[model samples]
Target: MPEAGEVAARVAERLGTMRGAPVSVESARQLPAGASRATYAATLVDAAGVPEPIIIRAVPAAEDDGGLGAEAEVLRAAADAGVPVPEILDVGLGDDSVLGFPYLAMNFIGGESIPRRILRDDTYAAARGRFVEQCGGILARVHRIDATQTPGLDELVDPVEALHALFPREFDAMPAGLVLATQWLVANPPPSSPGSCVVHGDFRLGNLLVDADGVAAVLDWELVHIGDPVEDLGWLCAKAWRFGGATPVAGMGERASLLDAYAEVAGWRPTEEALRWWELYATVKWGLICAVQANRHLDGIERSVELAAIGRRSAEQEFDALLDLGVVSPEVVPDPLGVEATVPDEEPHGSPSSFELLDALAGFLRSDSVTAEMSPQVRFHTRVAGNVVDVVRRQVLLGATHAAESAQRLAALGVADQRALCDALRSGELDGTDEKVRAAIAADVRARLLVANPKYFAVPHP
Candidate 1:
């Protein structure tokens, strides 16, 4: 809640013991990556003629009731266990005299986030392998520490419960098809064979501060919990976290290596089936989160274009999961024909610009909806509708329209309608083989991508 400048000033003051004299904030820049917490990099000058640079990470005052205290405790425990992490210089409840919110000051980690380059380039071919090793290695140590030893971290939710909690309350408002999918998932919960360990609730490449050698510090503990070790693995390799399309897992390492490294150090190798279940659960959980964020935008609590865009992608992942789960037939996917023709080559006919169109879409996304007075659940999806409309608008503007075109084309090609497609999967319409569903979803996604962004979809013969 504190202004960035104020938080930086407080951090400078807190570090006075380390450097001596009244510390003053020399500079501050907001670190822009997370959804839940606010972070800042602060440069401090201590009158003792010493230069001190510390990162000030603060949980908003609203979340301060227990999150920050819990994080500080977990970081302390991890540090004590020799897990690589920023040195915690000071932890505070924060006052008007200091920062406007509860804050923690840590030694500023120096290095580009490994994910900044590794996920996008081949220069870091070994980066993925090494990243996974460090994760498994450090987490192995984190698991070794007794949960009781970590102050204020007692009542942590298990992975299964956590997964269910992650679903958007608004999801109940989705079409009957999605509602049915939800019921199926709830009825068939992932197995909860319990284990005892401290789970890094959001451990993944992005959450880590890393460099060429390895992980500098495993950051972000707002979601830390005392639960099964595999929960961390499940979260780490969630497809949603894999910024890249599909090749690498979790935007870092190979899926097998991630498990292998953990098994090598932890002395317990997880079956691929077990990991698959968690991975699927991860997708569902993240899907719910996206849905929730979109709901926030819809409700006008937060209006972010990126959130709206990414939120719609959740269902794509869910459909992919159904394919993975063997509930749907693969190759029987509907073909694309009529759908591609409906999309205009260029809407608004190239006057202002693509950025202008996106800005217009953002504005439209924030406009008050006719369903503004609806129930909370309905309101959530009305928000989603606004976002989806913008996406269609963007696809129209950017010449990469994907989904609807594919659906129409599939229907034209003598494929069943949407209702039949859902029923076929639900009623064992195809031979009861999982591969069929997987193939079907893959084909549909490829077509949708083509419609969504044909420019990106276009390829020339070498």
Candidate 2:
């Protein structure tokens, strides 16, 4: 990865050559939230002395454009169709000399993409007020885009099956809740909308740029493909994307309003069953993605506490899938992670037990005095590291209890373990729709979430 100054220099060189004048790098900063590419927001000044702001998306030389070249073409088509998207300035898809890799540069649009701020901040009251309608209208436009305008749109074939295949590949022992969702999904596949259209493979809060007025630009076009457009709408409605908001539509608005807005623009509305099916699919897909991220840490590829913490969050998606499947138990589990359960008087791990030490560390990391001067990124990671410690602490306190209970549930189901339970569900040897099967799976998921994210239990769901 190149440093900030190197990115600025490269941006200056590329723009200078294109503008036929000398250009100077004014500034460059790394932007958060891109998983696959290193993204830099940069400023450059030409001989004319006007500052130009742009975003550079790049991959290593070894990956060579990493499908970013295709994304640029999608942006151009989307822009032509009246969708608010970044204006592409230059692309080094076929050429890499500028940055020693494939790159895409675009004129940057300033906006907030953070879900918490976009949903809660008074600064974005107007955007929050109109998010559903605006996002629906934007999605309707996104779906209506011509696939012929971009050649590779058809490459992502049958996303539903691809997701089904990906989940098993990521985990040695699949969550029982997800197993039920998979069984249900495979048994009741939703019929795709009549004609194929351009689907923004990921269209949700984090990917949508918002200003006070409303959504400013639809970002992250890398997932563009030819598929059922309802996938975009359904993905937006997934509870995982809601980020604990009062409403389900990106946690900012209602689904009815979104459908009304989309119908007004697209001249059609997806059936409730189709929307439900796609939303369930989206949940399963996200769980699989969580597994992938967690595996990256466990496999020694990234070695991040954040990644390890994210792996634990797969339970969040698992629980959400069960919620969508209507098999979640009405009984709520108490928040287990935040509780300060103490060690025995005869401390086995010696003075200041592991759990007690973690409690102290978590407290210090969260102290305003400690975090007050830290940068936002550092503070965020510090918080994550604190959570990672908390997870370990909770595991130490509750791991055996949870494990015994999980094993007991599995035994009641005539399965030896999670892998056996998941295998039985997948092979249809065990009835996923059975009340006992559903209840056992739900209990296991609740236990996982209780340890991984007890606060997640507070999030309201249907």
Candidate 3:
């Protein structure tokens, strides 16, 4: 919660102590790194007028579960095992130390972590061509790190059980899709690991910084843990991480190319079915994660329009999991929000109604006049704000109809609500494989997308 200037000043003092020399801050600013933490890019000027750039990564003391010191150790282990990573300069674990939070300082590595530029910009065209092979090689190296030697690293739990606990907690109740996916995962476990090794819990385009040549350095070590090496590959290929790319491997290359490169480096390749099982598990994991993010706003942890909008995206992941498990497909029903209905000139509120004002706000937020001069973080938030406004507008238009339909479908299945329906799935009274259950799930997902993101329906299946 400190100001940017204050954070920069602490960095100067911290690095000064590390080097046993005077250091002064030249400049510092926050980067739009991740949803839950703060990352600062800072420059320090020595008394001799030499300049040095570094990265300061901080998590709130309340949220630093795996001590930042442990993360720093993992980074060193990763680098020693041939993985490209930023050099860790120092770490602070005490609340009163440095910036008054758990944090780490590292030498800065320059590259683009934004998927929009890396996937679309001409500057990274060559990177796009080689991302698959390079990512595979990097991930293989990541899995080679010896977790036993790494201090404070969390031993992997049963991933499916972890997700099962998370799902109902985040949503306040489980859905039929969750029960279906859980049963599928339990009944169809993947092959045992080659041996327990490191898994980068989140290894996708957002964390891989790519320069013109290729991946410059791997960033974000907070999620590193001891787990099956295949977890990294599955997390990478999750549909939710594709970020609008056409291909499956972080939108950069084909699945086969990634597996081939990984096989060449690791001396083995997982069966396609094994990979698919892991991928499905990851899809379910991401869905609940989106809900957890939304709750960060709803529960007042970090209120932001961005998180609220992302809450709706959990439905898309649920939809994807069902499609993967052969429980449902993208139904081609006409979008209800696309209706060409005329509005009454004299509305209940006024001449220019509440809906009209919402539309005006959305348009203004999206207008270049408003966002052209904003910082990258502000600009991204502005876009999300605009999308969130549209979601509100569409919900106002169709929420009641969607609610009625959901209730009717639940009643038809002899359940009182979604919660009861989920209970039925568990008791074997209602089958996930039944056509009626699939129909209800598909309809619920379609309504959600109609409000959250209508275009998601058009994203070709990988």
For candidate 1, the 10 contiguous residues with the lowest summed lDDT are 453-462
- Give residue 323's error in model 2 in angstroms: 1.5
Candidate 3 structure quality by residue, lDDT tens digits, 222-270: 7778877888898898878788777788888788888899999998887
Q: Model 3, which residues run further than 4 Å from truth? A: 61-67, 165-168, 328-339, 342-348
CA-lDDT, candidates in order: 0.61, 0.80, 0.80
> Candidate 1, TM-score vs. the true structure?
0.71
Of 1 and 2, the candidate ahead on lDDT is: 2
- TM-score head-to-head 1 vs 2, winner: 2
TM-score result, candidate 3: 0.94
Per-residue alpha-carbon lDDT of model 2 for 1-462, expressed as tens digits? 578679779868877888889989888887754444678888888788889888888875334567787788899999988899999988886655487787888898999988888888999998788888888899889987878889865544666566655455674455777777777777787866767788888899888889989999998887677788888988999988898876778887777888889989999877778887888888878887888877877887666667677878888888888877777633455666544565535445587877778889999999999999986666777889898888887787888888999888889889998888888887877898899988888888887887888878767775
- Alpha carbon RMSD to native, model 2: 2.2
Sorted on TM-score, best first, the list reads 3, 2, 1
Worst 10 residues of 2 by lDDT: 338-347
Instruction: For each of the candidates, give the backbone clash count.
Output: 18, 0, 0
lDDT, residue 26, candidate 2: 85
In model 1, the runs with Cα more than 4 Å from the true position are: 1-3, 17-20, 61-63, 94-97, 114-116, 121-126, 151-158, 166-194, 245-248, 326-390, 394-462
Query: Candidate 2 — which residues are off by over 4 angstroms?
Result: 61-64, 94-97, 154-157, 165-168, 171-173, 329-333, 337-340, 344-348
Question: What lDDT score is found at residue 261 in candidate 1?
Answer: 79
